[model samples]
Target: MPKPLYQCRVLVTATSYGVHDPALKTTLESQVGEVVYNQSGRPFTAEELAALIPGFDACIAGLDRFDRQVIARADHLRVIARYGTGVDNIDLDAAREKGIIITNTPAANADSVAELTVGLILALARNIVVADRETRAGLWPRLQGISVNGKTVGLIGFGAIGRRVAQKLSGLGCQILAFDPYTDPASGEGLAHFTSREEVIASADFLSLHCPLTGQTRGMVDAAFLKSMKRGAFLINTARGELIDEAALIAALNEGHLRGAALDVFTRQPPGADHPLLAMPQVIVTPHMGAHSDHAANAMGWGALNNCLAVLRGEEPENRVV
Candidate 1:
């Protein structure tokens, strides 16, 4: 492929692509005019990003905060290609106001995330993590586990990952209930029924959150939400961590109102080693590996790169968000 007429400088803030697969990095480097890898292992602070991004023409955004202050400093930035689906971390309004094109690789990691959601549900239902720990310690005690078969599972979001979760659970004879006002009820292929959010919370034996973190959804699952759930019901969140109040979750579990919880995302990226949730025997936690599968990482990296390059080349990108 020949270089575009105008070669634009690119800053890749997502650090995992090179580690996941060097070919992904290579593909990105070959297309863009210039590329800068994030030297820091983690996401850049607003101050750090603002200073680093001024010279770059496009950026591959990760979980970095691109607030108004940061966006204001990006004098030469033309596009922001988000490495993942959720763009809540980016200041979309600021980007829009600056006339910077924003794009995300939606559904690029759907299969991986959806699979992880089902895995969490199964782990919580069957006490897989608990059982493994005990057996490893030489205490071979059998524990009672709930079966998902014939049980109803509620999905709070009916997007790509939610639909895949329902489809996967249907094979296990699990009934699905979905609560997303945006999706049509008939689109669930008879595997799930679209219903009121309140109904799903009260009726389902298991409730899984797959909704995006928006102004409407932030801290949505608080005391009231937990109180409305069926007693001893299980909760699974593979979506945004800010959706559920961590304090409310702890209280619900302690009061015996809920059985167990499985979390893939946390309000904090890395909860402390001695975090209360980590010490809980009933709770299962994974370090946000919902979209860490090799296939998903590769697709997301490639998509983010191409979307950014498209804008640099003055072409319309498929995944434009702003």
Candidate 2:
């Protein structure tokens, strides 16, 4: 027989797991014997996880490292339910070998992330951040900005979040170009023009990245890639940070090859104040908060909570990755 719910111990490492909805924690606590929260207020390291995994029946994970060594130490772990969509931090091969089910709440934060992507694009085109700061400092200069009404916007990936971004921008009267090898070209028929990667890069006035981080895509935005972009075109990235080579981006900005960049993610989380990117006036940065909206946070919490409970109850979980 399966173990009683009251005897199961669950570890929650995602800092935002229940912050938007407290009932999620109440529900999990009612069903489990013990619920341990990560008090660190950040993702735990592999060393910390390896030390903590032995007694947990499951974990609602975040951006924490889950390597082979950490998986091997999860003696009582039956599931690793990711609180958000990405599972790039986990070692899937190790989890599969250890018979630990892996799951994620896919598309839970797509709308929120898409909205943020559009917002960043606008912010960059208009010099909004600089304008706001200047006004606050008692300067009254009229800042020049471009309108998206007649611009060509290019999207690198056409997944759920990317599609939502295109849909949101549809009414703006801008020409939308998208490049995604994995998606059906017919899907973007009315909303966007499916095109070659080379064409999108060469023609767009605003280029936005919505792609996933993979070996092939990592550092795809090197110096050559930036140099090839339309001069003075804006770049927006709401996706992974490692996708762009930071040094190349810095050089591109220094040489005025590109107009500006707005980033929601970085090569390192909470980049140091002295970081060159942080010092650039043409660069805008956010604290990786694209998925922090109440709507998205609540959805992700419930999705992860349900996935964790389902696996523990001997039922098949949704969005199972391994």
Best by TM-score: 2
Q: Global lDDT of each model?
A: 0.89, 0.93
lDDT, candidate 2, at 65: 91
lDDT of 1: 0.89
lDDT of 2 at 282: 92
Q: Which residue pairs overlap in candidate 1's backbone?
A: none
lDDT of 2 at 68: 96
Model 2, span 254-307: residue lDDT tens? 999899999999998878889999989899999999998999999999999999
TM-score of each: 0.95, 0.97
Q: How close is candidate 2 to the true structure, as a TM-score?
A: 0.97
Q: Identify the runs in model 1 with alpha carbons over 4 angstroms from their true place.
A: 1-6, 18-21
Off by over 4 Å in 2: none
Per residue, candidate 1 scores C-alpha lDDT tens digits across 241-305 of 99999999999999999999999989988888978888888899998888888888888898997
